[model samples]
Target: MTFRLTFCSLIALAAASPALAEPVFNRIASFATLDNMAGDEDRTRATSAEIMTATPDGKRLIYSDSPLGAIGLIDIADPRAPKPLGNIAMDGEPTTTVVLGDTAFVGVNTSESYAKPSGVLRSVDLAGGQVVANCDLGGQPDSVALSPKGDMIAVAIENERDEEVNDGAIPQLPAGFVLRLPVKDGQVDCAGKQVIELTGLAGIAPDDPEPEYVDFNAQGDLVVTMQENNHIVVIGADGAVASHFSAGSVDLDGIDTDKDGKLDFTGSLKAVPREPDTVAWLDNDHFATANEGDWQGGSRGFTIWNRDGSVVHESGPAFEHALVRIGHYPEGRSGKKGAEPEAVKYAEFDGARLLFVGSERGSAIGVYDVADPSAPVLRQILPSGIGPEGLVAIPGRNLFASANETDLGEDGGARAHVMIYERAEGTPAYPTIASQDLLGWGALSGLTLDPADSSVLFAVSDSAYKNQPAIYRIQAGSPATITDKIVISKDGKPAETIDLEGIAADGKGGFWLASEGNPEKEIPHQILHVDGKGAVQQQVALPEDLTAGSTRFGLEGIAMAGDGMLWMAVQREWKDDPKGQTKLLSFDPATGEWSGVRYPLESGEGWVGLSELAIHDERLYLIERDNLIGPAAKLKQVTSVALQGLKPAPLGGALPLVEKRVERDLIPDLQQWNGYVQDKVEGMAIAPDGTVWTVTDNDGVDDASGETFLWSFTLGTQTAAK
Candidate 1:
């Protein structure tokens, strides 16, 4: 199998091969951590679902909630719809959890400060939600695992260093170690504890070993990853170190190594350390690590290693590059840790041995068929919530779950969530659109259909890539493929400071783009005309009278009307307009004259505004949405204004208001994917055959899940309700 296959090629392979047409994972439900809070509790407080584990029957999932200092439970009796079972408060911050029979062993941190670290292992009864036992661990705990035969439990005591002190350098004293205890008849024997010292094992931090994650293979051998030390240690069932080796390093090529507000994959990294985070076994002989770098290094991918620490295979930049093709690359984190592979899990289902690699920054999971551990094949990339920290697979029930630990609800963003996916007989439903030929793309703000071919479309990036504004030519299909990219240039260089939000194709091999401006930033609100080669030919700024009333929420969409006029949609109301009405401005190139009319907006909890515009079949279509995400999202829909009787008034005067009829409520369409409802429905275009295409803005994967959805639908000719 080829290693450099793009995401589209993988999908095509799965579709073409009968043997490969097996059950694929598709997200079926998402449970928000906020739902576990009591009705009287402050829902505004932060919460998280980090490390997770499932019951033997796979009917329940338990995850550690560090912020809430509790363990959250979810009942998955019906895999399609997960229900929150509330949370059980712990003595301190919960770090990890593992289920053995009806008991859950959780590691909790109760440290007062970095100098005085303390932790405990608590055993809870799953049915009654009560702590049954507690064992003092003498240090901060990070990861916990159960033995294969359920006869032993292991915990990684990571008395981690304080980054603020001496820049988080190691040898901070009170060296870390691993704890092993026996399990008797579904109960923890706290008194039968054994300590395995890890000092003098790593070259980087020999004394202060910070063990990040721990796992057990089928033979009860434990694998521990000391991330900051860049070392891996394996212990036998008798609690003796069997093998220890440095996680080593790799030289990365064809990667984006800077956070300069653009996606440039021409850079390279030399001798980057593979500071492994989560370690999981593929069998007794081989294991894998998510090389999530710490303070010094992170190789931006995963590594397959033998028990003796020899490299079986190194992903290098392939995993991160694969994410780049799917628009999940975290450009904002490029300078620090690109895509940050932080979690790994190995599971077998129906004779297929698979490995799941989770990207902490990119918020995606790369699935691979690792039947031949020496050469793993890239299978699919699954989208998760922001900051996927934990993954659990229950082969018994053919279900998998990811614990996303980032919660921005207090700031009106998506809350932490546990997304559940079920393996069934169908194709993967994610990655509705992807780029080919390694073309990195995201933040799709506007789209335009080609006049010559309805199956071809064009899209533009917003200010997310202000330094490298580009136009992407797309092949509009079931899973849209970006075939080409043209950088918008001025004076033989990439344009700068342009916040392109809308695009319209010119009949004569050119495009009309609407740039949404920020007055405070001095990015002018203007319309630009670019030729087929993406060279700026002309720029038209708003009139002084109109600019006087403008704010940052300026022009969002532009469309060429049938009457040879360019119509642009202003996102929100300006100072000169009445509340709940935004402008629909028209420009006649023949006369260079500007006119305008107001479009009424729907009443909603958050501010509603226009994001895109398209003119088709004598009707002007617009995407109207509120600035809310997840379950709070409402009013994401396509609305239309009939152009037959529409009239415009002159600028700096009383503008006529046009009535809008709702064409399609897009909230249902977004919900069909079974993920959180995205806030930015920023791009839409209509094919000549009346098909309506839409795309979402991922905000350049900054404080976002970076999941782009490109879907299409057709509407009937009947009149819609206003």
Candidate 2:
């Protein structure tokens, strides 16, 4: 039930609260109802136009109503006293936002002009209380991201919908484009000193890069999440196609795994399959991805693979609930409720010891111990919120952070906040929701944990249209202490692009990132490699081709290989162009060299949803969201056909079907829950015991009784010729 409290009651509670009180109740009981500015009078009602972000110190919360054109800052430094800091008026509605130092980069646009877009990159100086730079963008900008040191800015530009509204459907809308500008001191060079255009990204829908999900690595590499082609575009500062990864364009609703009831998290109850946006790494050789299952009742999940382009495991709908729980019915006699199969949306390994799974609809985070890969066991569960988009593990303090994209309601009110959990340093690990920070602007989009220093973190939001997507450098104050934030933004500009989706720190003092450029023009996605000081060292552009234009599968997910090379995941394109095929590639950090291109999946390949990817011990794990109708939902494994091709089984030495059946009979019950039979699997992690831990998206199969589950598996005994 939704609860509302008065301002006086909140103050009284805070005054009487203890310094170290832990919030044990569900979210609804903890967070207060934000002041509604839409003037709708329904104060408790929430919408999707709000933005949220964590502080650079991982403390305090910031939020803004992009549609309402107002910013709300809350001093979450004290979880008990989450009071508002202040509010600021925006020029227009903010489509996306980014924060750096004391400045916030905001994208201003009008809601009425769906297509006749006009905006500029405005720099909001938090300390100065004025816009430092409001440079005209020529075209409407969608997403934005700052370099590690805040030297470069990227924005996604799109076509003017109203300008060419009658121009024969605007030629299916020109491809999305990205603009790269250099930021120095407190000034920005927006006069097109360095501009890169990406054309031919098919399947990208209108307002394609909606939830500004863009990122940049230490070396200034860029990765932009595009919903149109459902892929992440990767480009360098020099305007080159470093590589590409595909996330088959699809949504995460209407999928069924067990055919129970209550559409599994957006009708993911049915299973058929899917595609990409977010990405993470298991190790140097492996990375992870977050995909949209399918548009028409398909599976939604993640994927994993090796640096050499080999599929290791694919899992989806890991948990299937058959038991029913009774809920009070007003009239009594309404009969029973079926089981629901919840799907897993995001997954990642915490410093190689624990596996974390985020469920989009489940609104929770599932944890697994990967000490023994083949026997990963559920260790604990934590309640999260809408679009639990990003996860990061802080090593030194044994802390974990989950980025909540929306408020308690997915409807998108401006109540988004960042939640932090920490495990006791002593014995049997116990995790408590330690603290939370309110981001008054931009929804929490993505997060990246620092391998070298857990105290340092990077987080961003995912909306490019209504502005307010930003990145924050957080310094941990204490296990329960609020964080100190340093917003990352362009030179002195308040308005920029939309989202910052991907973020990776270069071990050698730098970072790599990708951002949604211009959505109006068919521009190539941008990637940059920057030094620790936040200086762009090199730049790359998405491959220019018909598929690149239509698919927008520019480089989406990215990771650093054990061999010191950068790996990228590309999405598939709908156009009949050779570049539309999804593949994995590698790039050199020092020489700006990109190579090792391998197409693991063919055009219109195996499944529809191939969202997230992870690589482990030379094995690639892909999250294949199978989208199908009726019951019987499943996930699939795309074992590297390249590896399968390596060992041809000596042509005539193939085992007979009868013999195969006999061998299968010798094995234990493979259909049992948690059983691994090479079905549809998405997220995976390698355990210390040389086994693999995996999770699946059930998509609420049996009567809305669907669930997310964890699984374990071992490598085959027979050593295949490698």
Candidate 3:
């Protein structure tokens, strides 16, 4: 550990005893090089999700591809030398992954058609140093959990089919079911396995639509979470419904499970299904979920529950009248209006429920009380300066993690870090100041706490800006510190940090990161790997297809799916040409290769800009920055796609689909009164229970919008427009 001891600390420690090992937060190299501008194809843009991860043995590093497809990979055997291996294709846009031995299960989805294999659940093989196989699934698989033996993979699947219209409008179906795929030997063939229908179990009408998330209990029983119904359905191995519990049911103060003299369940767990989100398993009988209501509701942060269907802890406030009372009214004498409350999700830490919750408007984390499963309560808040978009946590060490972006003066900036909390009682819940800042030390665009040890932290910075961002490490110790940054340079001079945004740890010895440069500048985009000592070991430039463009091909969000492969999401470059949609790409960590296929969103699909990118279990969770719409940000999940085999249909379409009403009413208000438009959504993280924890970059609300507010989205709930 390279220690950057504070001048005073160095003297005291040295004078008293041998100086403790400290990690120095030094600069390495910057990424620069414009690509595809000189009439050359292969240009790329930037997104906020550029993070990396290492293999279990620390021999290779994996990174995501924010290109047309949703995945990418890298090899990092040498600290100062990184290389790109190969890439692959997926059914839907790829998000996150979970690695076992040689297999990686990826989450994907398509619009309104998740019942079939629209959600591509790919099983990648990394044993041969290359991706050998990829598979697709019927439902939009959100998260993945492998049984102890790595067989019978439980994937939370959701089919967002359209609900029926009263007149001759487009038809929509209720939410679909979650599937448990059995990975036998080295292959994944869903047709040969048993598929359980979850619609009926959750009381979901065949026409009321909702998404499904699944996780295994301590005994390996499947716990399926439905955002619409606000319930968890336990599926036994026999494929029969074991039990069903309400996410909205809370153990009231009058009814105590422990027979204590206090209120048992304060606020119930409500279903705030906004978009593709997450849920987490707290323990064998306990679980935590994000309570951001559906398109018609509002919630902030997560809630804990016990197996007997009781709320143990409650954070934030409860939803009344099926809606989170967003007090937007102003007092008669005051000039300011009320601010909106937020929600939480994407939690981790087994012993303690450490969740990363952010507000749709405010850039902060809502630290809720989860000590009890029947009565969780909101306790403190961690304001991450700008938007707290993503979250990661490591238990047994009191370490909480998050990622966000801020302005470095005129130089727009981003940061990712691991904050060590003082778990002692009365410790002032959320520290006004961060335990340690990984700013210049590293990029806070993406970060992850080492599952192996919370003391070890990894972070990645987006280099798409002029300063080529890099990766850095931080170790927990007295006067806890950061290490020197590590990034590869071209032609001896470090490139301007384009956007080294995403990061992840392999839980072994090494770390990985992804970088995206300005395509208009014609610079090459690639993924890099680094050793614990902050050395650039390997690097891989993106593929031609991913970079072929003179427009800005923004490659950002990234993560490691299972199988040592990498997944990425990129914003389509907008230039002189007409507006079109972007795509998700994949890469191979073993050979620094690229997959030719890309998963394109629906035509006319538009995003204000993509920010925080995350993956958990087997699903992908990405945050679309404030898109001039209702609420301040947009959270989306890419679950299923229409893929026939290795081939797909044509590409080249309009921006992401935008409803006419959304454009006029929902989108514009995000900028309310803050002279400048709000770029609300920024960072994002996934909890073990499948909840999506995201932060906002409200840049301060406009006068018309009243006070500034942080926001969080529960999967099925609808939120108020900014």
Candidate 4:
């Protein structure tokens, strides 16, 4: 089930990294959810890791996989390289899982209808991977928690309402409550079950107090989040309600409120309800909630609260702003809950008390040092796989784990994944290039090193921000930052029909941009010359002979050759070219003539094509990568075609094949990020001082973690300090 391919498992490195921060958590390994169902089953089906818990020694992990109707397990004996222990079949959908000693207690939902919901508590032996006991519950369960003493289990019996009926308005019958079961000798004592009533407490939907999530503190006190009702409740050890209150609202400012193709965070949401999704006991007297709103509102942040329902600290828009600064903001979800913080976990790491908040939509987790609960400090933000639904920390081993619940298997996209991270003395190994919103940006597609200053670079965003296509000026510093941005303009307005994928600097204080064409989308395959002021000076259309043979996978990168002629790299084979070959087009600015040569491409599993082109030392350096992601990504390299004897033939004539030499296998550099290999290695450049810089596009935060990795290598040249 764990296929280890030497070629794909190779880890490439760019620079030697010591600790960037004294105590930081860095990714160690990633396991795909489909690996658990790799036998005779249809592994292509959707799978998920909704909730998870690790063993006492951190040697194994048990998680709920609802889509597969099973409890999945992973052997973390070697934490850095986790191996799948396979999934144990469950009679019903497992909602949440909790580990106690040698057994895993799971809440299983067997509901056939909303009105008559039913569930069961199943205990599975971790050693034998078999269900040892099952206890029937009168209602459905959503979350499961274990007592601090490991003597009792708490289950949030959420008889949830159907979203399809009347927009999922609450008070729709069959109210829910909390179920506490005693544990005797590592086995759940079903005979000692207690159903604690939790209805007629919420002001909005008092008749249906649907308990969504439950977490227990050391004093046998439990905090429950009634998500739909926007309420919170605390239950004491005697199975009696202690105190309850509204989760409350927040007035958020400087937030994006629309999906209008912009990263503008100037809008505001006033009096928004903090519909809490996941709750964690910050301490015996305090707790935290991720405000993932339902129908009413979502504060787009997190909040810390006292047991008596007093707000201690409110994140408001600060967390989402951190995501925006890292280019992980979900612009498409602006109209909804930005980032949608859904999971919260509290633990002590080393000598620091920490809180981990997971963003379901942004695919990011914000780590906070909660030593001072009233004023928590944002320590780090870890990139998670799509839809991080669950988080578990293994402090004993200094390891952290995330259960990412998104499975795009039906679309042949990335399956659900579980990522592991270790606390160590080293840099984060991600975001070599990041921003503090010096200028809001995303989807960086092309890079152009400053012809004069080796430390200055310029990059461009693609059609993702079609309404305002802009080129960013980057300061190649330790954490290469975006210092400024220039919006490309047409007349007096932002260019409309543009998909700027490549950029090249002209000698006359201007730039030549190659916009990949999508004719059906009204965008033409053309090149534009822009003055230093960012105004369009001239536009050149492809010759009819070449235009007729082009596809949407048009010109990807452009560079200036030795003769002052502009050269562009076609991403893929066109209608006229043979298989596994694309064109290196040349356009003479002085003569207004066009010629082309064939660039041979190596065959791979997925389509392999050029993404970027840079002219360094008279050779055409190009970034070539496959369209696949993760382990399926077999090719991501920088290859150069010597220009010494290269000649371009006229359009419609037989083109010459240019031989290439592999300059760098970029997979190593990409692997240093420690997550999955990004599919786009789109931008590459060589500084005047010989530093090799490259960037991967974030796809404008669409179905992505929106992590744009920018790093430099001094492979063949001396590393220079900027």
Error of 3 at 153 (Å): 1.1
The per-model lDDT (C-alpha) reads 0.90, 0.41, 0.43, 0.85
Candidates ranked, most accurate by lDDT first: 1, 4, 3, 2
Q: Which stretches of candidate 3 lie over 4 Å from their true place?
A: 1-67, 72-91, 110-117, 127-130, 162-171, 186-192, 202-209, 249-277, 318-353, 358-361, 366-371, 374-698, 701-722
Per-residue alpha-carbon lDDT of candidate 2 for residues 584-608, written as tens digits (9 for 90 to 100): 5455667655443334342222344
**Candidate number of the best lDDT:** 1
Candidate 1 TM-score over all chains jointly: 0.98
Model 4 TM:
0.94
Residue-level lDDT of model 1, residues 389-440, one tens digit each, is 9999999889999999999888788999999998887777888888876778
Model 3, range 174-194, lDDT digits (tens) per residue?
346656677777467676656
The top-ranked prediction according to TM-score is 1
Score candidate 2 by TM-score against the native.
0.43
Cα deviation of 507, candidate 2, in Å: 66
User: What count of clashes does model 3 give?
Assistant: 230
Looking at candidate 4, the ten consecutive residues that score lowest on lDDT are: 1-10
